[model samples]
Target: MSLLSGLPLQFSIDVSSLLNVVWLGSIFVFFIYGQRLQMYLIANDISRALNRLKIMRDKSRKEAIDYFTSSGKVTGDPTQRIDEFLDYVTIMPVDMDPRGVVEKVQHITNTRDERVRAEVSQIIPNLDPTKVSVAENILEIATSLNQIHKIVRHYYLLGKKTNSYMLLFQLQMIMPMVLQEADALVNAVDTFKLGQPVGDGIGPVIASRYMQNLPKQVVGKDTVMTVGEYKGRTLYVLKAEGPMGYVGEPGVAIQKLIEEMKVPLNAIIMVDAALKLEGEKTGEIAEGVGAAIGGIGVDKFKIEEVSSTHKIPVYAILVKQSILEAITVMRKEIAEASDKVQVLINRVIEEKTKEGDKVLLAGIGNTLGVGQ
Candidate 1:
């Protein structure tokens, strides 16, 4: 035993020397290929995000196809037809001259809207108008998700192919926010499918509440108006006709009320949901001046142009919420904000317009799952 033990510790290692060698090897490897390793890591992250986006995009597309086929309205498989609609693109009007550009933009956008509506209607001819609106909304969401996925994939493949760290870095940085948006849109698909009121419906909800028991007439395309007296002032309240997903032609409605209908208005009061900052409360209320509408600037431009021509004072009451909350199902807090908005509207009207004055009240936003 003693002789065997003395034969020596052949496996013994110098701990300090071993650690130094390992540390040096690691440093050497990283020093030579650090950028490559980082690029691989970043690409891996982006690949994962890209996969998620594809899933979301495909899910919404399937939802749209299912919605149409299950309606029993179409005779054949509508997958190809629906796919064509998803890939449809609208070329924006050239803005070089910047003169009469608004009208040009408006015309182009209106045409696009009509075309989209007609295509959807043709596909599901027997579906109710309300249900058709829902299908359109779902398709719109799907289109958006598709666009996002394509864009992400394009950048990812390009970045990897070219080994562009800057490109990859930029894309990686934005992926989180992009994914959040895609997720929100995915959630909105369910909300639209169910035809439930969303946070954006807050504006129409307030208008409908005030419009109770009042006679409303069609003012514009899918838009309605009701006349009522509040605090000794004639209040003309208008909102997008609903219980379906429709923003209607709110700008057109307001313009018609003033210019075509010859309603001499002392003041214009607008209420809409506004995107809130990160720290802001969900149902926070803010009052401002201007056209309180959100869209492709067609509606806002119309309102601004007309109100300026008449020198009418425009006031805005906004209910703040996040972008996700705006499109998804209506939150309890947002629903409660409607009551507060009504009170705020009263105060604005009373303070801005004198007794015996006429004021146009435009509640602007998508009117989904909300009534006239």
Candidate 2:
């Protein structure tokens, strides 16, 4: 105290004692309320994220409603009906027995698709098939956003009611990823509304270009095929009948080509967009062995089944991108990678099969705004 007194007037009164008291006070306060403080901070973060998600969901829903009313013939306000439609749910087929579950799932999926299409058509009776497809996609994006917001809000309220810091913390951790997907879907709504090509369309883009000037015909439900020759190998190029927002049924098409049509194939070469890891670069290409399709496990299961049964080796060329990139507008890097994919496909065929062999070249992904 004497030394402090010599230093300055403000430091003259019991400096050491004051320091000890302040340290003890802070420790005592934190010891009693540290957990509460942490919970409060985490809850604040979750609340902010929850608000953002709500805004996105609401905005998407409004956009969908407006699109339906303006573009389609509607009597009175369609808001109520659209809201009801947004709540549509799909009940998955039970997989306990694990036999014929795939067919059941496919049936349910087909029925759901038909229902959605019919509803959209009813809402906008004036829209052509292409516009109807676009409208269906818009409604789907809104529904997805709506579901995501509800799920997050449920968890947040439940955690708050229970005063469970662990539960809140878990929600906080996943919020960023959840937001990322939500944001991507929001962008997709606009892209789809305008009928623009998406990153998911890269596969079809590659196929279309490779099969340029060749005559194409319907090979499967909403799927198409063309015959071409690549380096003395007979190429059976298959893709979704495009210039529409359709993924078509690549698995069914592949099976039909090999099984139904009895196109003797040496190997199957698939090209599709793949989701990239956090540290990975977008538009990077990788070659692998398998069906490179993404969707409900139905399509993937069918492809694997047919390929295995017929003993046809399947090769995949993947163009890696983020989930955001895959749904939103196609990036320049991804668009440029299509050229590289073609070259890789040629190499796979040359190395995997003989000169006179038939190879099924399948480009698997959505064909939105991509011409056949």
Candidate 3:
């Protein structure tokens, strides 16, 4: 009774009002806290996802060290290109489709190619023919890094359209992971001094090996293709020649070989690197019928155009690998896959061609680490 008497008069007579006040206050507090809790949870999830991506990027970086060392090509630190390359990224319009966008990319690539060649020539007067490949790789690595930054930044800006703070924050957190990937890619490419194979080089590797000990003829301004006998078939093999900077004008070379060289091709076989599925093994080779090439489709179009006119059956042999495997230092598995692919090519020729038939076999892709 003494303690109760010390309380305010309102506590004595306003019991229902006080209880109502407390109940409303509790609801308001919970509403604010619930929103805050949800924000934190979402933020936490985004952080976790970004962290996983970073881990994958880090693993890729570690693998790159070995790739560079084994290739025996990279000399100086090529990593400096990656940082300066960011300024070169093209800001693509959000409304544009990717199909048309690569045209601009090709233009950018060509410019870089010219710039790199000139720089290399200037640095080492009467440059060693072998060093040309290294220069090309440096320029290509710069372009690739720039493209990555362009892609990530483009999307990050697009996300800003929503005007959501949380969304922007999520994208911001993921940027470093992408940059890390760019760094890894640049280092690996600098190490290899060849365009990352990206499954595209398989065809060239096979073609070069097949053409071994055969006479190589200059088929185009920059193309070195071979005409030789393989398994009782007269094989006209075309690929971008290398060991000096070259991925040859394959599209132009193929068109000329059929329409101009008039080889009387019985069958047209294209071997190239193919993108593997998520669960697919790296360096797995598959045989089938189709173009089996990945690029701006210029080469594929020319091949199809000439083959269609001549009524030749086009066959495909695809070497499977992930984008990473294809573009980074040439992996041993991929190198092994090349030998296996040659066996398959021989089998394909035997099954598809008759004795003395003139056949045109094209190893289509960048022939950086390959030769005629």
Clash pairs of candidate 3? 196-327, 197-326, 198-326, 198-327, 199-273, 200-273
Best-first order by TM-score: 1, 2, 3
Error of 3 at 177 (Å): 9.6
Taken over the whole model, the C-alpha lDDT of each candidate is 0.90, 0.89, 0.66
TM accuracy, model 2: 0.93
* Residue 219, model 3: Cα distance from true site in angstroms: 1.5
Q: Output candidate 1 Cα RMSD.
A: 2.6
Q: Write the per-residue lDDT of candidate 3 for residues 7-113, one digit (tens) a residue.
A: 77757568878888899998988787865665555555545544554444444333343433344555554344333432444444343566554456555555665
The TM-score measured for candidate 1 stands at 0.93
Better of 1 and 3 by lDDT: 1
Angstrom error of the Cα, residue 102, model 1: value is 1.8
Best by lDDT: 1
Q: So what's the TM-score on candidate 3?
A: 0.69
lDDT for position 173 in model 1:
100
- Estimate, for each residue in 257-354, the C-alpha lDDT of model 1 and write its tens digit: 88998888899988899999989999999999999999999889889988999999999999999989999999999999988899989899888899
Name the regions of candidate 1 deviating beyond 4 angstroms.
1-18
